[model samples]
Target: MSRKAHSFLHEYPRIRVDRFTESRERVPDFLLPPRCRAGAAKRQDEDEDDDEPGPWDDLDQDDESTLKANGGVRFFPAPTIQLLSHIHADHIEGLSAPLRSSAPIYCSAATKEMLMRLESQKSREKGACRVPMGEGARKRPYEWLRVTAKHAKAKKKFTGLAPAPRDLLHALPFNTPTELRYSPGVNIRITLLDANHMSGSTMFLIEGHRGAVLHMGDCRAETWWIEA
Candidate 1:
């Protein structure tokens, strides 16, 4: 008898702050907390008597699932699908140009709009001649990352992977349960919850035959919010 393959959730190692100093600077200010930018000298000393946890200290670390989200780079054999919780550049960095996969990318409608705007800005900065849309005119954004010819050639030589198609973007509605066929016999249900961290930020709940997992992507949890 053949044994069933074990499935588990995976996450890429967190990037060290010092390693991406320059890149981190470009991240939007609203995405970072006040303490994250304050130097050691500017930080207030912790009160020994005050044992209360800070705002960002509360987090649930235990969860299980076969589905992966916001971790496209670490999948060696490539994932069948990708889930994007928000439009934050850091979370989507791995989906950048030159590294391609055919997996369908899922995200919120607001996130898709923001990505399209960002891409349009990038195109204009590259001196690409484009006409401004008239009133009520809209252009659909490409789903894949845009790579230069030089980077594309280098990527092809090093990793023989094809570029991810820009047409595979899917937008999910908040709080709606979406069914996904993960494998031949496995089915997963995904629900997107508002994270309240930023515009279009989301928390993913993935439930499968094995177990369920809640993946919080950059969420700001409040006591009241949790108790409710």
Candidate 2:
């Protein structure tokens, strides 16, 4: 729920946002909960493993109630930000519902350490999840661990609360420029070139006040991206 301070991370800047919530309201539910481990049944082998679908799958609830009574003020807006141009497997097929919202998932610190090692290998194939491993006290070489929930949050019959992939994972460093104020009319300013189309690939260049966008996520040619 935190992590939006710039100043190159230090000397003071994250004075707030320990809990960000501005109603990102993005619901085109990619349902995945029938006691997961890919169980939900009916999906037909995940629709033949499709990948050619973008724009959050589906949504047109009266066009989001007319952009929530007209604040999306025209054109394209309400889908704040989520640019993960690497970690292929057909680019993370249907990202389970944008990896469970609170959106802010840029990428590339080796794709956030390969999404924290694929959430610790889905917590060792969950058997109700429990990855208890510690002891680095005076000689630390391994520490970050959180695949918790022997009974996931006091169990309400659980519905997906075991992925702590470094919270909303924002890494972006390839090109620089990074301000992403999620609300107040969604100010942008992303930048992540270097999409040689592989290891930690990236491409988005997006600018501000609903203006520019370069999203070429699957590139190949080089030479500084053909002189950018």
Candidate 3:
């Protein structure tokens, strides 16, 4: 069965796609991301299996494409801050671009701990988003072809996993509110509430001068979220 969801939540959800599995780990034989640190020539052997499953292989549509259709993260310019609810691959499509940018990323402490387990953000793309991500539902052409263990070892520069930069990741406390002073006039109060979806799953309660908006990033609950 697919993972349970906070189906009623229609507010600001980061990832809107309904998933086939609870998390990225459920995909069997999950290979490294279908990306290379540098561009490579297309596969030489005609018989070579280019369809090998990568981390997001199981996903039919990608988050960025969904974002493009739904009109959110991918289309909007750099947000005030980046917030990650969890480390699931679906929630992280088009992730490399944000990681490469200077925008700070915020999440619960658990999410930060797990970022190390994800593919390293170091990549070949240059300058501030010279090429936009989410151009393809699957891997971008530059992020083309799955990086198998054999391919990774053969390609000396491909290190699938590495430590996220400390300065870029921000861990916020659940329940307690934190203030983001973007400018003298632009300030926002953000509070993280437990979504009870997973170890670090959360919903964002963002309050500004105009109003309060709750962003429920992929979650699976009905009511207790408001109590948080």
User: For this target, which candidate reaches the highest lDDT against the unseen true structure?
Assistant: 1
Return the number of clashes found in candidate 1. Answer: 1
lDDT of 2 by residue, 1-228 (tens): 112211111111111111222333322123212222122334545553344433322222236456457543222223345557776555544343333344555777887676555533344445235545432112211112223444345333456444443455678798887887744444567788887877788876766543565767577987776887
| TM-score of every candidate | 0.49, 0.26, 0.45
What local lDDT score does residue 208 receive in model 3, on the 0 to 100 scale?
63
Across residues 135-195, which tens digit of lDDT does each residue of candidate 1 receive?
2233323333434466466667778975532444568999999987665554677888988
Where model 3 places Cα greater than 4 Å from the true spot, the runs are: 1-75, 96-100, 119-166, 222-228
Query: Which run of 10 residues does model 3 get worst, by summed lDDT?
Result: 21-30
Residues 70-174, candidate 3, lDDT per residue (tens digit)? 432222122335667776766554444423345456788887666543433332242234555442222332121123454445445545553332345678999
Cα RMSD, each candidate: 15.6, 18.9, 20.5
- Could you arrange the candidates by lDDT from highest to lowest? 1, 3, 2
Candidate 2, residue 39: the lDDT equals: 20
Q: Which candidate, 1 or 2, has the higher lDDT?
A: 1
Error of 1 at 144 (Å): 4.4
- Better structure of 2 and 3 per lDDT: 3
C-alpha lDDT of residue 45 in model 1: 67
RMSD of 2: 18.9
Candidate 3 lDDT at 62 equals 34
